[model samples]
Target: MPDNFGRYFVNAIVAGLVGRIIGVVKTEYERAKVETAAKLKGIGIGVGLLVAAAAIGFFLLGVLITAAILGLATVWPAWLAALTVGGAMLLIILILAGIGASMIKKNKDLTPQQSIDNIKAALPLVD
Candidate 1:
């Protein structure tokens, strides 16, 4: 009976140790997941900004081309046509800025800290 009790106690201790190790592993995995998600979100934001800037640049370029064509067709001074195109470009920039601001305001919920906390809470460690 004494030997059996000792063996059972040893088994219980080993089981508890295994459970603790598993909990640590799960916590670490959750942390890694949160970090990766944050990094991906940042990358997505960078790509979006780059694309938006490129689109705006292309739009301005088109406006300039159109102005040049108009100046040649109507015999207007090239300098005045260029100035008008510049003003139009400025107006487009302001409109884009307003759109960007509104979009940022709407997407304010996915903050970095909140994302981390939400992931941590979702991944509860088992003992």
Candidate 2:
């Protein structure tokens, strides 16, 4: 009976260690999932707000262009005033689009490179 005591003790220790490890892994996974969901929600809200702001800005711009056309109509023909306003708006749009495209081209990954570097640094330790 005493000879089996050591075997039972080792088995118990191994089981406990595995159980603890599984518990820790499950907790960390749940935490990561919740955090990721929260971050995605925040990003969605931010994008929605930005799109709303852009829509409002465009509406204001349209109003201002109409006002400009009306103001210019007092001096020139209505058609010429409209054409001038449209041409200026087109020029502004082109310039802004070029800048936006260049910025997009220069953009990097959204994920943090530092975190990836840290993970890489830790991987060698595992071996």
Candidate 3:
């Protein structure tokens, strides 16, 4: 009888531990899901900005081509206008790049430090 009782007690202890472990895992999963969504959104926005900058760069290429053709003409004013537009396009590209750089930089550190802390709090090391 005593042997049977001891086995049942151990089973009960194991069952409770498994339930707590499952709870902790579930909580961490949900937290990670939310965090990942936010991070991905930020990354998507940054990528979109970069893509727009590339498109504008291509457009600048066309403008440069036009400017080169214009330079072949006899007016200094046309060359001046081309340089002005080119300068403006370069500035725009720089601004977009800066914004995208900051965004990507912000998202680069994706370690779940908060999750780590929570797990540690939930299950402290025995040592």
- TM of each candidate vs. truth: 0.53, 0.56, 0.75
Please state the error at residue 10 of candidate 2 in Å. 0.7
Comparing 1 with 3 on lDDT, the higher-scoring candidate is 3
On lDDT, who's better, 2 or 3? 3
Per-model lDDT: 0.66, 0.58, 0.81
Q: Is 2 or 3 the stronger prediction by TM-score?
A: 3
Clashing pairs in 1: none
Number of clashing pairs per prediction, in order = 0, 0, 0
Error of 3 at 14 (Å): 4.8
User: Which lDDT tens digits does candidate 2 get at residues 18-106?
Assistant: 78656655665565566556555555555554455455558557756776867666766665556566666656555555554444443
Best candidate per TM-score, number? 3
For the record, the alpha-carbon RMSD of candidate 1 to the native fold, in angstroms, is 6.7
lDDT of 3 by residue, 1-127 (tens): 9999999999999999889877886897778777777777787788888888888999898888878888888478887799689889978988997898788878766666566667678867511
Summing lDDT over every window of 10 consecutive residues in candidate 1, give the lowest-scoring window: 118-127
Error of 2 at 42 (Å): 0.6
- In terms of lDDT, model 1 sits at 0.66
